[model samples]
Target: MEESKAGDLFAEGVVKHYEPELKKVEKQLNELTSKQSSLLKELQKENVKFSSIDITELTSLYQMMKEYHCRLIAMKKDILAAAERSEKLKNRAMKLKEYKQNIALENAHYREAQMKREQDLIGKPGQPL
Candidate 1:
């Protein structure tokens, strides 16, 4: 019984750990995706109104575009890693569920045994009136 309870706690700990990791990855992904999207919108706005811009401004815009491209690449890698970790998190949750169910079953068996013993004691024919 103690062993079963310990196993349940260990499984719960594993699930708790992976859940935070998954949230961190998700937050990072959201930041990167949002930055890339904002850059795209800014570029679109420039396209409609910047054909007559000076050379210095054009150079600055080009640099920003290059940086955005690099960030997008990094974001893609993060998303892939996050997907893999999500699968691991799901498996961990399943294991935790199974461990808890097993413990409950063991506890129920113990209670049922106690009840049977009480019944036997009450029915013993040699007992005092």
Candidate 2:
């Protein structure tokens, strides 16, 4: 029981810390999504411009576009990883809560059993369990 209580406390602390960080990551993901959309549109526009322009300058621009695409992919990957970590923390917190509940229930059952044993031994008022 004590161990479970301590685990509950630790899980709560971890969950408390993780919640705000998860929100921050969510916000960052939103911002990154918007940025990615805008960049994609810009890349499309650049492609259109490239189609009409000379090849000499497009090489550098193409490199820049490729770099931008890579960055967007990396940001998406980071967001996925953050989401996974957040889910793990949430699951841990829920399990801790369940553990605490189970411990309390088991303690109650034990106490009830002890009471029953005492009643059986005492034989209440000429009666027995």
Candidate 3:
């Protein structure tokens, strides 16, 4: 039971430690996504024609969009991995709690049975009441 409690606490700590980092990454991903959308909208407004815009400026915008896309992908992957890890830790903690509960319940049952046995012995012949 003690071990289970320790393990549960450890899992909770780990999850808590990473939770903020996970949220930060998710927030960055959302911001990046919004930026990407805005860039796309700008490009659409321009009809994406190379002849109307300076070549260098268009290329720069394209590069910036590309970089944002790459970063967004990486951040999304990071968020997914973090979420999976957090879920696993939560499951482990829950299991540990259940195990601890089972242990406590078993101990209670054992003590009850032992007390009943003592009472029976007290009523037995030649045994102290």
Candidate 4:
């Protein structure tokens, strides 16, 4: 119960903490993809063949693209790790809840038996034991 709530809250907080960072990474990847597409389109319009392009002129762009790709891969790994953590937390919370319910049910059965025994001793509110 309470433990589960606390665990869930903590998990949510962790997710929230990383959400913005994930979004920023995704935005950067999108921008890079768009830039790459536009660059390719411009080359096509100019009838520039890949072999005819100056490697030196495009070296920086290539480096930047590679860096962005690496960052994207790192971000993906982070997101996967976060998802695994969240799943583990959820399983823990569920187990805690199930254990709490089982304990409550056992307590209820015990209380019921106790009440029955007391009623039997009292002889059902009658005159005899």
Candidate 5:
């Protein structure tokens, strides 16, 4: 019973530890999404303004678009990595919970067997159970 309680506590701790990381990743993804939206709007505006053939201005806009694309890609990768880590932690917690349940089931079976033994002893005197 104590061991099961300990396992539960450990699993809870693990879950709590991952919660902050999950929230952080979600926040970062939200921020990135907002930035991406702004960049898309900027890109659309720049494309409209590109009617004048200024090579230097076109080059600057192209570079800005590329940087925005790169950052968005990197943010997506980070989000995926964080999601994978969170899933792993959840799986670990599930396994720990299963282990504790198995222990409790085993303990219940042992207690039942002890009770049966005691009952048998009451029926039969000076007999080894």
Candidate 6:
């Protein structure tokens, strides 16, 4: 039916719209992860030489590492939120597809019944062939 087609299209559109947003968030997460890894490596190297480092420089490095860690956590949360939104859109699309199939099946059954009625009336009293 026209309504079924419209609903399917709408659901697909929503899914398509969210897909780009999901990809962007995932890319951001990947970049943040890479930065986090590099920061960790640097921190490890600094830790190994902690006793020989100047106190002020060490403090500055620690503060910068903490900020990077916080940002990494925020990126991870954004990715999770985006993923959840994308999943919901996908589920809606699937449901719309199922609805379209059901509509088609119902239409088929109705048409078959109408055809059978027409066949039965072909030679009936007062009904034209």
Top of the candidates by TM-score:
4
* True-vs-predicted CA distance for residue 75, candidate 3, Å: 1.1
User: Model 5, range 1-129, lDDT digits (tens) per residue?
Assistant: 999999999999999999999999999999999999999999988988876678998899999999999999999999999999999999999999999999999999999999999987687777666
Ranking of predictions according to TM-score: 4, 3, 6, 5, 1, 2
Q: Write the per-residue lDDT of candidate 3 for residues 89-110, one digit (tens) a residue.
A: 9999999999999999999999
Clashing pairs in 6: none
**lDDT of all predictions, in order shown?**
0.95, 0.96, 0.94, 0.94, 0.95, 0.95
Which candidate would rank higher by lDDT, 4 or 5? 5
Which residues of candidate 1, in runs, are more than 4 Å off?
1-59, 124-129
User: Which run of 10 residues does model 3 get worst, by summed lDDT?
Assistant: 120-129
Kindly indicate the candidate among 3 and 5 with the higher TM-score: 3
Candidate 1, residues 11-32: lDDT per residue as tens digits? Answer: 9999898999999999999999
TM-score of each: 0.46, 0.44, 0.53, 0.56, 0.48, 0.51
Which parts of model 4 have CA positions greater than 4 angstroms off? 1-56
The residue ranges of model 5 lying beyond 4 angstroms of the native Cα positions read: 1-53, 122-129
Q: Which stretches of candidate 6 lie over 4 Å from their true place?
A: 1-51, 124-129
Q: TM-score of predicted model 5?
A: 0.48
Superposing all C-alpha atoms, what RMSD in Å does each candidate have to the true structure?
39.0, 37.4, 36.6, 34.6, 37.3, 37.5
